[model samples]
Target: MGDYDEDTAFLGQTGPYFWTTFFLLNTVYLSTGFNGLYMVFIGSAPTHHCLIPDVNLTREWKNAIIPVTIVDGVEVQTQCSRYKLDVVRNLSAQGFIPGRDVNLTNLELEKCLDGWSYSKEIYQSNIVTEWDLVCDDQWKVPFASSTLFVGYLFGSLISGQLSDRFGRKKVVFISLAAQCVSVLLQSFSHSWKMFCVMFLFVGASQISMYISAFVLGTELLSKTMRVLFTTLGAFLFYCIGYMTLPWIAYGIREWRTLLAVLSSTSVVYIPLWWLIPESPRWLITQGRVEEAEAIVRDAARKNKVEAPPVIFKESELHSLTPSRKYSMLDVLKNKNIRCITLMCLLLWMAINIGYFGLSLNTSNLSGDPFMNCFLSATTEVPAYVVSTWLLKKYPRRALLSIFLSLGGGLLLLIQFIPDTLQYVALALEMTGKFGFTMCFSIVYIYTAEIYPTVLRNVGIGMCSSAARIGSITAPYVIYLGTYNKVLPYILMGSLTIASSVVNFFLPETLNRDLPETVEQMQECQGLCHGFRKTKYVEDEGRRNQPIQREAKV
Candidate 1:
C-alpha cells in the first residue's frame, strides 16, 4: 500500500537493531533446556552407599557396587535414562544384594536412600542439578521451563492483539520493558517460585517483541517488499538465532551465566526510541494521522525529496472493512477460513514438535553435540536459497507439499538404518530439517494470504500459537521418556504429509491484489482469474514501451 521510501529499508538506526538482535538471541532460555540435562552421561549423580555382607573375598570385591549383580554368571550394569536417575533410593532397589539376596525388601529401602549406595535407579537420572551450574537451589529447572513456555504462550496470543489495539511501536516498548524486567528478576531468583513468577511475566513480554518487529518492518515497504521484509528478514534472523543457540551455550558452558548475559543485553534497547520509527500503517489504523504524516515527512527529508501534498489519503492507506462484520463465530461459519485455520494449526503443531524434538536429539546422536548441532543448522542457509528460487518459479503450494513429503520420507527411513551408520542418519535428518525450514518460511506467506486483511493478524497469531503448542510438547516428547526417540520424527513427518494433502484445497496467492475486504476474497474466484490480470498488465506494459522508445528516438 505504501511506496518505496528510505524508512522502509532500515530500522532507523543501529540501536533498535541491537535491541532486535539481543531479543532474537535471548533463546538461551530454550537453548539451555536439554543441554544441561544431557550432561548426565558425563556428569556425576548424587550418591548414597549400601553395604553388602557375607560376600567379601578381595578389597575390590568388597567395594563392588550394590546396584550391579552377576545374573546367570553374566555381569549386567544398567542405569535409568541419564536424565531421570534422581529417584533411585536404595542400592538393593536397583539390583544389588545389600546383605544377602534374602535380606532385601522394598519396605526397608531407606538404607540405600541415605547417601552411600552411590548407585542410582536404572535409567533414572536428575541431570538438571548434576553440578550446581550456578550453585543455586536444585529443584528449579523444570519450573523454569514451564514458566518460559507459559510466558511464550501468553505472549504469542496477546502480542498481535496488543499491536493492533495500541500502535506497534508502543507495544514494542511494552514488550521490551516487560521482558527486561522478567529476565533481570529471573537472574536474581533465589528460589524456584520466584523464577516461575518472573518467567510468567517474561513470557508475556515477548508478545510485544514479535508483533512490533513484524509491524515496523512492514511499515513503508511495498506490498511485495512487505512480504520480503516481514517474511524473509525477520523470520530468517530468528532462525539464525535458533541455529546458533547451541554453539553459544557450549561456549559459555553454564546455563545460568548464559541466561544472565542474555538478560543484560536488554539495556541496549533503551536507545531504540531514537533508532526505530513508529509504524505508519499502525498510526493510520489507530487514528494518529498527524503523527503518521510527520513520520512520512521525515522519511522524505532524509531522502532529499519533498513530502507528498498529503502523506496518503486515509481511504487508500488501510481498511479492515469487510462486507459483513466478522465475529469469532464467523471464522467457523466460513468453510474456507475454517479449513485454512485447522490445517494451519495442525501444520504448526507438527513443525514445532518435530523441529525442536529432533534438535534435542543432538545429544542422542553419537559424537559431539557442538558439531552435530552446527552441521544441522548449516543446511538451513542453502534451504533458504533453494526456497527463494523455487517459490519464485513454482506455486508455493506445490513446492511446500513436496518438501513436506521429502522430510517425512527421510524421517521414516531413519528407522531402518543400523546404529553404526548414524552419521548418515544425521545427514538425512538435516535434509529433513532443510525441508521443514523451507516449509516454515512458506506457511507465513501462505497462511497470511488465506485471510482477508481484517483478520490477518488474528489468523496468523492463532496459527502460530498452535505451533507453540507443538513447541511445548516437543521437549516432553524427546526428554520425558513418554515415547521412543523416533516417534516425534515420525509424527512431524506424517503431519507434514498431511499438510501437503490439505494444501491442495487452499487457493494459491500469486499476481493478485491482496484481498482487503471479504468481498474481494469472495470475488477473486481462482488462481486463473488472478493470473489473467497479471497477463493483462504485462501486455499493457509491452504495448507502451515501444511507442515510448520510438517517440524518444
Candidate 2:
C-alpha cells in the first residue's frame, strides 16, 4: 500500500463508525451556528424615540415636546432630545399648540433626561431595549458585537495548539462546556459591561469548540468524506442553525431568554464524550499504538468487517518521522510561499470584512430584520452548493476572482440604488452576500491546496488569523453606516475589488497533486501556465496505463 493509503487503511473509509461520527460532529456544528450569529438579534436596535415624561400636560402638549430634527439630512422624530418639559407644560397651560401657536424648532432642546421609549412592534426586549443603547449610546451596540469576534480571534490562535497538545476530543468537550457556561452567564448580566465581559468568554469558547470539532472530523473521516464534511456536512448544519436563529429570536423576543435557550442546547452534546471516539490518527502520532489499534479494532467490529490480528505493518507503524518544526517564519522565508501567503492573507481579510459587515447590517436593511437575517442565512445554502460544484470544475484563481468581483460589483451598485427602490437595493445586497459567501468558502480550499503538507497548517492558520483581524474590524465597518448609510458598502466593495484583482496573480491548484514538500511546491510554480493542456495530457497518460497493471491496482 502507498503511504497515503496505509495511514487510513484500518478505519474502513465508509461504514457505521464514519456515519456515526459524521452525524455527531454535525450536531455540534448545528448548535454552533446559533451561538455564532445570535449577536445580530441580541444587539439589534428597534425603532425608538425620546421618552416624553408625563408632567400632567395634555397629550397634544406631550407630543409637541419631542421635536423633529434632521438626522443624516432627513427630518425624523429626534431620538436623543426633547423640548424643556417645564416650559412645554407652562406653554400648554397657556393653550400654546405645536407648529401653529409656537415655533417648536426654535425652542430650546434638552437631552433625553427621562430616558427613551422603544417601539415593541417587532421585539419585546433586546440588549438595546434592556440598557437603552440608542442615540448617543448606539455606538456601544457595535462595540458589543465586536467583542465576540475579539474572542474568536483569541480562540482561533489558541485552539489549534491546545487541541494538538491535549487531544482533539478533550479540547472539544472543554470548549463546548466553556461556551455553554459563558453564554448562560452572559444572559443574566445586570450591566452592559458585565454582558460584554462574559460575551468575550462566549466568543472564545464557541470558536474554540468549532475549530476543535472541525479538526477532529477531518482527521476521523476518509479523504472524500473529509471534503464532504468540510463543505456539506458541518457547514450545512451551521447554515441550518443560522437559518433558525431569526425565528428563535423572533419567538423569544427577550435577549436573556434567547441566550438561556441557546446555551441549554449545548447540554445535548454532553453524552458525545462517550459516543465520539478519540482520533486514532492523533493517537498513533502520539505513540499510543495499542490504544490506536484498539480504536481501529472497535471501528472494524462496528463496520462488521473482519479484522487482521494486526492492522498495520511494522514499516507503516514506524513511518512517522520527526521532521524539523516549521513556523510562520519558515512560510515567509520561501519566496513563492511568502507571496502566496501574503495574497491569501489580504484575500481572507477582505472576504471576512465583507461577509461580517454585510451580516451585521441586516437590521439596517429595508425589510423585517428577522426576515432579512433569514434571507442572508438562506443565501448560504445555494452559495455552498454552487461553491462545491464549481470547486470541482473551475480553476481556484479564476473562480475566486470572478466571485469576489461579482460580490464587490453588486455592493458597489447598491450605493447607486435610491431609497425609493429599497427592495431592489435589498436584492442587490443579498446577491452581494451570496458572492461573498462563495469567496469565503472557496478561500479555505484554495489556501489548503496552495501550501505543501509540511507548511499547510501554518499557512492556513496565518490566513485565519488575518481573517479574525478582519472580523474584529467588521463591527466598526458596520458602525460606519451610522455616519453615512453607504460608507460600509463603499469600503467593503472597494476592498473586495482590490482583492479580486490580486487573486489573478495566484497560481491555480486545479488538477494538481497536493505538494508534500516545499521543494515540490516551488517546482509547480509554472503548472498553472497551461492548466487545461497539462490536465488533458496528464489524464490521457493515465488512461494509457497497461490493462494488466490497472487490473492489478
Candidate 3:
C-alpha cells in the first residue's frame, strides 16, 4: 500500500481546517476533566457528630450529650457515639450541670441512633452528608467512586472495538450524548445506590468520549503538531476545566447543583459534529477511498491550496482495496505486539494509580478541600507545558521513565515530611502531581505511536481498560489513609518506580512514521540494543515498484 502520510501530503499541516478540527475536538477534554474528579467534592465527608435532641435539655446538657474522644493527641467529639438519652434527660431534669455535678465520661454511651449532624462549614449537601455515609456506612463512599471507574473499564473495552469498526467521529458524539444524560440523571439520585448506578454510566461515557477524541487527534494532526496537541492543547483545556470545578463547587457548595451545571455544558458540544470531519486516514483503512478523497479535497480547498488531480494513486487503490478486519485478540497473538501491549498495560495502570490516587486524596490533605483540589488541578498546567517541551526534544522512552521516577520519588519523600510542616508535605504532593501529570501526557503520545492504525484504537482501549483497573483501585488505596496516611504513598510509590523500570523495555518512536499495519510495527531489540524499523523497500532498478520488505536492526 502507498504511504498514507505521502498520499495526504497535499493537505499540508496547520491549515484553517486543521486548526478548526483541532480546537473543537480538544474542547471535549474540558467536560472530561470536570466529570472525572467531581467525586472529590460530591463524596467529601464534612466534619460531623451524633445528633442530640434539644427539647428538654439545657445548652450545656445538649453539648455534653455527644461523647468526646482523644484523636491525634487532641480531644474531639466522637461521630458514632453519644451519651444515653435517658441518662442525660434524667440528669438535665434534676438541673445538674455536666462538668460540675457529675463526670460525663462515666455515663453510658450509645451508638448514634438518632442519626448524625453534619457540619455545614464546607458543604451544604453531598452524597456523604445526604446519605449519611459515615462510620458504619463509610465504605460506600469509596465504593461509589469505584463504580465510576468500573464503568470506565467496561466503556474502554466497548468503545475501542466500536471506534475501529464504525468510525471515531460516530463514537465521539454518541459518548458525549450518553455522558450528558448519565451525569444529569446522576444529580437527581435520591439514594447512594442510585447515584452509583448513574455514576457508572457517567464514567463509561466520559472516558469513551475522551479516548475517541484523543485517537481522532492522533490520526488527523500532522507529526509536527501531534505532541503539542496531545500534551498541551488537550490537557491544558482539561486542566482549565478541572481547575474551574473547585471554584464552582466553592460557590455552590452542593453536589447536585455542581453536577447539573457541569453536565449541561455537554449540550454546547453537540454542534461540534459538523465542525469536525471523520478521519480520512480511517476511511482509507476501511476501503472507502472516494469518501476519504472527498474529505481531503474539501480540506485542501479550505486550506486555500490546490489539491493534486489524483489523491490516491493506482497502486494505493489496488493495495488498500482488500480490507482486513482486526480484533483485540490479534494484538495478543503477535509476539512483538503482545510485548508492547503488556508494557503499555502496566505503564498506563501505574500512571493512573498515581494520578487518580493523588487527585482523590486531595480532600484529605491539610487545607480547604476547594483549594487543595484547585491546586492539584492547576499543577497540570506546568506539567503539560514541560511535557510538551521535553517530548519534542527527548526520546519518548527515556522521558516517560524519568517522569514516572520523579513522581514516585516525590511521593516516597512525602512520608518523611514532619506532620507539623504540612505545607512542605503538600508541596511534595503537588510536585508528585506534576510528575504524574507529565507522564500521563507523554504516555498517550507514546502508546498512539506504538500501535499501527488498524489496531491503534483497540490497543489504546486495552491499555485504558488496564488504566481503569488502577483508577478503580485508587479510591481504595486512598481509603488506606484512614488506617495509616503513609500506607497509600508507600504502595503508590513502589508500584510507580517498578513501572518506571519496566518502561525501558519498550522501543522508542521519536520522529518515526506511524505504522500503518501490524507488519510495519517497530520491533524492540532487547536491553542492550535499540529498535529496528520495518518497512517495504521499493526496487531502484524496476519501472514498476513492488512492495517488498526489509528490516534494519
**Top lDDT hit:** 3
Q: Which stretches of candidate 1 lie over 4 Å from their true place?
A: 1-63, 66-77, 80-127, 130-147, 192-197, 312-325, 480-483, 519-553
What is the Å distance of residue 421 in model 1 from its true position? 1.5
Full-model lDDT, candidate 2: 0.85
Model 2 Cα shift for residue 502 (angstroms): 0.6
Order of candidates by TM-score, top first? 2, 3, 1
Worst 10 residues of 1 by lDDT: 544-553
Taking every candidate in turn, the Cα RMSD to the unseen true structure, in Å, is 9.2, 5.7, 3.6
Better of 1 and 3 by TM-score: 3
**Model 1 residue 424 distance off true place after TM-score fit, in angstroms:** 1.3
The numbered model that scores best in TM-score is: 2
- TM-score of each candidate? 0.72, 0.92, 0.89
- C-alpha local distance difference test of each model: 0.57, 0.85, 0.87
Work out how many backbone clashes candidate 2 has. Answer: 0
Error of 1 at 523 (Å): 12
Model 2 bad stretches (over 4 Å): 1-4, 7-11, 70-75, 313-317, 522-553
lDDT of 2 by residue, 346-461 (tens): 99999999999998889888779999999999999999989999999989889999999999999999989877888999999999999999998899998898887889889998
